[model samples]
Target: MRRRLLDIIHRFYLDAISRLPPAEFRRTTGLARGLHVGGHCFGPLHPVHNIVVNSIWYAAAFPVRRPAGSDDEDEANALLSTDGIARICHRSLDGLVAALRDLCPSLSNGDALWRLFSTSADLTAAVALANGVSKSINYLSKVLVPSSPHEPSVSPLMLSAQVLDCIASQKQQFKGIGNQVVNVVNMALQQYTQRSGEQLKLHSVCGASLLMEEGLENCYHINFLAYHEGSGSAVGAPVLFFTEAIILSCYETDIRLCVPVDPVTDIGCCFACESNRKMVVHPCYDEYLGGLEFQEDEVDYGSDFPSPLDVDYIFFDADRDSAFANYLWRDSTDH
Candidate 1:
């Protein structure tokens, strides 16, 4: 059943990519590649994990392009409209959730976890709306501020006030949805623990945290850090996959955030001794990690076995790069 679900997910993912506009298709594929590279720095993830998260990220970050004569108000209204790629992705995600519910009938009985999956469509739409508003505000800011001394200068404070005023209603709507999302996430986590007999901790910086830490009211710039008790010794594949999925789902969504630092390279560079020539460390540490004597022995699995529990122990393979590239680039002109 799990393998069948994964196959359906893979097909849905490909269909979503195929339906995207040409430019967005390229951007989505590029984002997926970037995720693969960044994730490989930490550990190998199942290919389906990458596919699922990439689809979500692309949907969330999908922009609302304003018509040539359309005003900011029109664009804002359009953002909330049930149309375009965001809506398409929402349908695909809904189908995916329905399939899951069908496969696991237990989830249909007022399950909080099921509710989370259902509400994610709204969350994705909210994120897209936030992105649209952010872009609109940015555009207003540029237009309000004089580019040359010949024009009258606008006060920075007044500019900010005006921008905030313009998006006040939209901000309120987004805030309401954001609050609901947080509540749903909490309930979902509780439900997850009850069912799996495992407690997952989520350390997130957004909403109130953003206001407290950076005095930024931008709710789109979210960061999630999660772990389980076993994370210290050996992270379970499911935990790692879900963590990556959640983080990637929120990434590049009007946040304009910095790339996360590579932990292994940072640690090695900071702590390595300069006296030992053999101890020299570089950013490319994949070889060193592979050569470590303490590394676990990997069995030679000749076939791709996607487990029912969605935990697949695997290693990164350089040979797969070409195949991935081909897969992403194939049928590019069709859309």
Candidate 2:
């Protein structure tokens, strides 16, 4: 994960930016490189916000998707799920604030929190330009309640609407503090999902059961590379790009929320793996529905989030597990 990500960072990214169209360079100059690099006259009033925002903008192009097995993890758009990236950003945000304090000096305590707000707004714009609907849905998952593991409850659409109502017309706390970031993140995620709820809800449809539990640990590793900072136990397992879609406030007082949804293998009506930490929530399609059914907003499910199931990344001309190895093993390394 780190290798491919670093390659993209050093090669695909830098090469592209340095060779940007002259016109685009002039037009987006203020946006691409703001106060961080110290802009010229008429530059954006705030560069820190824009720089983080732009990273999110680029991230929208990379949506989270089912990880294809040995076939390779590259060429997949999902750099991070909404929750995944947010976690990353939370971490990165802290790192930036820590590194910046000694250097910027003027901004005192609580300043980092404010910067997160400004950066979040920029990310909102980026999400709008790309997968507007999925992003919207992603944001909505936070408030919506999924049904339990074994029940067929309210339709995702209906559940989503209720969740939206809670968010859109709420007197909820923190609603006004980071107003710009909160509203836009909510808007972009809601719209993104509404438009492509079908594809976005793939995991709910798959219904695959967990295959390898503790046995699979350390057997494989993942890497998620992206621009946002993060906090998690990818456990140094090469899970790069975990913050592809995130906004951060702070760790103890504030943290990014994420929902890592995986598509079920087309043959079932379930999801495979779902893992989460003590503080995070690991909701299922059913549990989310149940929450809405009972009007429960602050309910908590114990530490039992299932892990993700590996997909047949190498679906060539057959439909067997061996077929995965046959095709996926054709001259490639898992990115």
Which number leads on lDDT? 1
Q: Which ten residues in a row are the worst by lDDT in model 1? A: 307-316
Q: What lDDT tens digits, residue by residue, belong to model 1 across residues 82-122?
A: 23333433444454445335534555433423343333322
Please estimate how well model 1 matches the true structure, expressed as its whole-model Cα lDDT: 0.34
Judged by TM-score, which candidate is best?
1
lDDT of model 1 at residue 153? 56
lDDT by residue for model 2 (243-314), tens: 012223322111122233332321111111222111212233322110123222334446543431122221
Off by over 4 Å in 1: 1-82, 112-335
| Total backbone clashes of candidate 1, pairs 3 or more residues apart or in separate chains | 0
Model 1 earns a TM-score of: 0.20
CA lDDT scores, all candidates in order = 0.34, 0.30
